[model samples]
Target: MEDLLRPIYQERASDRDTLGILLIEKTRPNSPLTDDFDVILLIIVEDNEDQPWHVKHYEFDDKTAALHVVTEELLMQWIDTSSYRRAVEWVIYGKVIFDRNEYISDLKEQLRSFPSVKRDLRKAIEFGKLVKSYSEAKDLYETLHFKDAYSRMINSLHYLARLAVIEKGFHPEVTVWQQVRYIDPEVYKLYEELTESNEDIEKRVQLMILAIDFVISTRARYSAKHLLDTMGEREGSWSYSELKTHPYLLSYGLDLTAIVSYLAEKNIIKTERVETKGVGVYQRKYLVTDKE
Candidate 1:
């Protein structure tokens, strides 16, 4: 049974020119000859789900007549498995990773392309909209909607949310990774290196958000000293002690020094030394360069 099955899969793997569905029918393991063509499987690349779940089948058939006749552009309908249901759920729930309203609105457009599923797709869309609204309204790390929607969809949604967390620079937690894996295990395997514990993830999220805010707020004024100083308050000038209190500086405590050095090296700022009489103290004052 393994010998016959392995060769067929290998043949399928090698045939890049033949794109579409591969129908494979195999006989029973116990009686390979009598049940020779008893099992049949339909393998089609699912456009909706990611690459791995692309293959789906329905019934089991084993017979010389049932060997998968392969080619591209041909779509396999189904065999015995709930591949269709899984595909539908993935599309509905995966939208949570992206903008929910926008995704559904586009889905409405995609459904129009396939006239057959358009009607059922619309009904799914109506329910999907409701689910999305609820998911978005909840606070970050606050709401967990795992049970309400279809299991496959919830799985996709959870993976998407964790991806958002990763993009925001906070590490995803093991539990978050688990949630994503429950939907698409492949994603977990792909991004396993970045995800961390919840506490670490929270800190990363805060840092990411803060960095973005800092960049936006400092666009007009391109000085690190100014960027660091003005991030928290409206005051014009802050003492060195008062400046250290800013979270912006604390976030990159070590890099902050290097950034200042870089600015000086670039001649963006002029650094001067002043000597105080008796105290013999040196102070550096920064002035914006003409190039800035």
Candidate 2:
């Protein structure tokens, strides 16, 4: 496969702006890692204002190839925010075919280290999604939608499992449950109870709802550290819009309402009502609690 991909990456390497190139071969049939393509050619280039990435499908000497033209800036954003989950996989598993000043090599080392700031951001984002989905699941259960609640609970658990893995200072891998099974068997057991238990859908959903609530509360302060820290940076309380739109928080893509509500419910944060245009009305704002 390298024989076929050599000239392609060579052509890119010839460009002055091209920083590095990596080749990720599909390890097995029907694998989604490379989108089932025979191979993936990841060409990293210097930042450009035009766009973040340009993707192309090619038939290189009859072997299917997926070309990803990504800029250094966008790649960094993806790594920081976990915007594109596969970005980590690419950097971790890719075979470095070309390197300019060992950029790709250093990046791999950085990811292996998994700095606390990046991990905290990923945790906060995952926790927000967990709270949102878990809340929806409970609402569904209240409405007697057992099957729907079960499916939502599955998603919620997936987020929780990822959260557990992140808290342990590891990136969630393709087979996250496999990682969770070893990292935190307790969460893996929750997954098993939800999926493998012989109980009817309603009972299983009920059981998970209670368990996940406790888990969320347990991790609330820790998982919300990034957001709480950001809010604490400024003196006054932050309106929901301000908190959600802040540049630092933007990367997390937070489900702001859900996170804020859960934090208030668990007393991790406090909410205040400020006077609005209407004399008797008020707008809600959130702040880090004094003790937090």
Candidate 3:
């Protein structure tokens, strides 16, 4: 492997005359020789099966100038095709490693896993673009629950997103969810609810309808438990603080204390804490007395 790669290393190190001949002679196995070492290396990476497919041209260049010159075209090809998978795996494995106090070992693992995801992602994006040409992916539900018929369409969008990540070297796992929230918060919320409930298609659809109605009617001011109760009855009352403590509230980001402060500031619902002489101070759940 080293001997096969030695020529490429030597070509860059040797003068333009000798380097040019060797690169050209090497291309006799193929066709269309040119002055560009860039073309030569590309062919080598693509056509040379004995060498690893994912090897970057810069591995030969230890200096900044040579590395930058050699990588100008090849880098873009890799970025366009393979970067997403590399970035994502880096984030996932990096996070897991740092969490375990084994950062060094994890870093080495990242170096290895990084290339596979890139190669896969590039292929995925190409596959996605081909699929997107024939179908449409207009919304979150289509991309999520109805992935069967629109699999290609969804894949295309995912691949495109991955491609962007690869180009930018960004890895935000919440990014996809944040995109859903922006595009369709109601639909996103419904998806979260249904996923948590583990309901079937019919149940999920029905729940989605209720969630839409909930978002439209009440401004999403109630806790999950209160939301369920309100859906069941169309009207109910409870104290703000007590609603926060409800067991189901974990499904949302709200905790008991934060819920009270938020509801009071928003004025979405009225609050009351009932103090009974024998029972002591008991906080009731918040009730939606009015809707604006």
Candidate 4:
């Protein structure tokens, strides 16, 4: 493997700040994400504030090499959030062509550990996104936007499937539905109802929306426990902006106000009005209730 990759590395010897190289071989035929590429080369580099790494692709004869240039910080972020599970898998299973002071080996160990905090944070974030998508679909449907509602509901189901997989302690892959089918068959069934049912479009969408609502009611609080825990960190209530800007919560693309509203409605959290000096007469603050 090293000999095969030596030429590629030597070709880019002038490129500085490279920490290591990872070579991921194609193990399965017709891989969905690989685009028939024979191998994937991931080059991990030190974060450079002056210049960002540029990605390149190359092909030789019947073989193809797809090059991905990622900074160490970005790579760690992806691992923590499980945003790029396949990439992390490659780092774990791929052959390391070279490393600067064993950095790549240490990084592989980190991926192997899969810390629980990152897992919980990732699950909470995904759950928040799923709820937000479901709410959007419901609002669109109520406004008589059937076509848009259908599209948004389908999007919600995708997030729902991902959240289900995350809840099971597995990082969802690009083929999320396939994973969800085995991990959470109920969500798969709902998806089939939406896509395969002979019912009218509106009725099918409505049925899916109902299923989403049931899921939100039953699972939202538990899935979002990480966010709720952060909200209760201080004795004072948390404002929407504060929660939205939270370091841990920001990466999930969460709808903070929507989540707070849902939690309030479910009596998991309570909202209070606090007068502010400049922003407004009063601002809504969310607080964890005893029920939480």
Candidate 5:
């Protein structure tokens, strides 16, 4: 692998701005680790001329390599948001072909530690997905759209599996089920029951709705810690609009309505009714309450 990438390594070895360059070889015969390429060269730079990342394909020694040029900032964003699960795997498992001041090494250590703030944020993002998908699935099921409801339930389960893994102090990998099975077997069992049941899809869907409600009810408050914590940053309550557009939540890509409604409904957060312009109407604002 070094022989194949020696050119890339030598070319940037002298560049002061180039902080780190790591190599990841495809782990399996049909691995998508390198997007089906034989190898990947992840170049971490201080800056990329205002571009977050750039990609190029090259033929090296009759094999393919995908070279990814990314800034350290954007790479950290990816890690924080779980935007690219494969990128997390790369950071954890990729080989350090070159390093300046142990940049990649320290990053791997941080990710392994799994800071509370990142965990809370990731859980919020994944939980937002879980709630929205499950709500849509419930609506579809009530309207007798069994097929579509089943599809939505699958998506909800996927999010649930991710949450389970994140709460267990690990980022959800590309193969999410593999992590969930050991971290939280009950959630994995729900996945198995929904997907591999011998019963008809409708029946499976029917059963999962009840099971899902229980799980969501239990996880709602803890899963929403990131948002709840944000709301606590100030003294006054926050309107839906304020909470949605808050800078702290800008990168979470969350479903604000679903999360806030669930939190309010559960009394995890209190509601304040402010009079609206119209005579008989009120605008609801949310306040952070005792989080015991």
Candidate 6:
């Protein structure tokens, strides 16, 4: 394996920005999990104020390699947001071929720590996505777009599994269903109901929607506490535009308005109307209350 990987490592090392290299070997034969690649190499580079990363593929002497160039900043973002579960798995399972000042090892340690704040923030973000997808699915169903609603429900189930894993203080892995099945069977049952139930298509969709609604009502406040905390960071209330552009929240691709509305409905947060300069001009702002 080293003989096959050495040349690739040498090639990447020529780039001055290269900081570390991780080599993940395929141990199972004909396994779909490997994505049909013999080797997966992650080349980590310093933030050079350029594009985050790129991919390269190679085939030589009957060997296949998938090369991924990732910036350290982007890597940390993936870790914090749980966006790149496969990359995180590679970090844990791959062998470090080379490192500049142990940067790779340190990153692995950081992931191992699994800080509470990061965990909570990621869970909140995932839950927010779950709610958004569920809402979209319901809208599609009401419009008689049954197929589209089914697809959206599947997306919602994916987010639900991720949220469940994050709730247990673990980074979600690539096989989210497998992980959720063992860790949180209640959440797993929702997936089963959507996919494997014997009910009619519309009935299944309705049941799944109802299940998701219950989850949103019970879990939204606790799962979204991080977002609420960000809103309370300032003494004054935050406008819709302000929260929409918040740097941290931006990473999650959240529907700020939907989240704010959900919290308002739950009475966990209150909205106030602030008048603008023009006559009858007003904007809505949100803030967490002491009762919340």
Give the TM-scores of the predictions, in the order they appear: 0.22, 0.96, 0.23, 0.84, 0.96, 0.90
Q: Which is better, 2 or 4, measured by lDDT?
A: 2
lDDT by residue (215-256, candidate 2, tens digit) is 988889999899889888978888888887888888655487
Q: Can you write out model 1's per-residue Cα lDDT over 168-207, one digit (the tens) per residue?
A: 3232343565555565464454334223424454443333
Local accuracy by lDDT, each model: 0.36, 0.89, 0.37, 0.78, 0.89, 0.83
Indicate the residue-level lDDT of 273 in model 4. Answer: 94
List residue ranges in candidate 6 displaced over 4 A: 11-17, 29-34, 49-51, 277-281
Q: Which ten residues in a row have the lowest lDDT in candidate 2?
A: 248-257
Tell me how many residue pairs clash in candidate 2. Answer: 0
lDDT for 85 in candidate 5 is 76
Write down the worst ten-residue block by lDDT for model 1. 74-83
Model 4 lDDT per residue over 19-138, tens place:
888888777887645546778888888876755445667777667778787888888878777666677777877788778788889887765564667767876767777778888888
Tell how far residue 163 is off in model 3, in angstroms.
9.7
Candidate 5 lDDT by residue in tens digits, 171-269: 889889998889999999999999999999889999999999999999988999899888888898898889878887876546888888878888989
Worst 10-residue lDDT window, candidate 5: 247-256
Model 4 regions lying over 4 Å from their true place:
1-4, 10-19, 26-32, 82-86, 99-113, 276-281
On TM-score, who's better, 5 or 6?
5
- In Å, residue 66's CA in model 3 sits off its true spot by 23
Best-to-worst lDDT order: 2, 5, 6, 4, 3, 1
Model 2 spans > 4 angstroms off: 60-62
Model 5 TM-score is 0.96
Residue 205's lDDT in candidate 3? 46
